[model samples]
Target: VTLSDLDPPNAYRISGEGSGGVAGYAKGGALVRLESESADVTVLHYDVDAQIGGKLAQLGARLINSTATKLAGEFFKSFADVVSAKAEAS
Candidate 1:
């Protein structure tokens, strides 16, 4: 994995590649940007690209996609909760 093209307090890009037994091999990258909507609101935008190969790709792409989507949703929800808590504490 690699983290680069950082724009402090605003954006960044991440990329990685790996291989496993059941999961096979995969490579992907994401560009994440933060945009200020208001004094107290910031919106995050992300673009991701991934390629799956070998057994995993041949097995079930739908299942893999849905799981990834679910995980991303959960991650953002948790992130929002933490951010809100910190703002309230401040």
Candidate 2:
């Protein structure tokens, strides 16, 4: 993942590309927004596109989407737990 853009302390967009269990390669980006003076972070958008020619022609879209969704959920769960632990420590 790479940080494509940032707006001070409130917003940012990231871009990344990789291959997964579904067969071929994919590219996507996300827009993240942060609440002021708070720990809340939201993903406003997550978009995926075929790396070859911008279409999920052969590599089933549902399968790839499901995998990405599952991974994102796991990541957020771990991330939130870490943040909570740090807050408790502080």
Candidate 3:
């Protein structure tokens, strides 16, 4: 069986299920979070816990910011600033 659905921000959740006779039925999903802004990007992931082999089917998500690349420009920097201010006050 196959299922598909649309989420917010143009994200898509695609899922499927299949049986391997002796092995049993397997189910999984792929999700893509598309950015709304022109500078944003689309993030892709596979839902694992919803599968038989939970860990193996899992997809990891990460947010990174470098001199050349950043998913949220200045977002991390602003967050750090807030933390630093709080720490200084403490």
Best by lDDT: 1
lDDT of each: 0.81, 0.61, 0.45
Query: Residues 1-34, candidate 2, lDDT per residue (tens digit)?
Result: 8996788666777778866544556776656665
Q: Could you estimate the TM-score for every candidate?
A: 0.80, 0.65, 0.39
Candidate 1, TM-score vs. the true structure?
A: 0.80
Residue 46 deviation, candidate 3, in Å?
6.3
Off by over 4 Å in 2: 19-24, 37-57
Collision pairs in model 3: none
Candidate 3 local lDDT, 1-90, one digit each (tens): 354576765666656666656544455454545453444323333332234433322332111112212423354357557766886787
> What lDDT is reached at residue 28 by model 2?
66
Instruction: Give the least accurate 10-residue stretch of model 3, judged by summed lDDT.
Output: 60-69
Model 3 TM:
0.39
Clashes of each: 0, 0, 0
- Residue 57 CA displacement from its true place in model 2, Å: 4.3
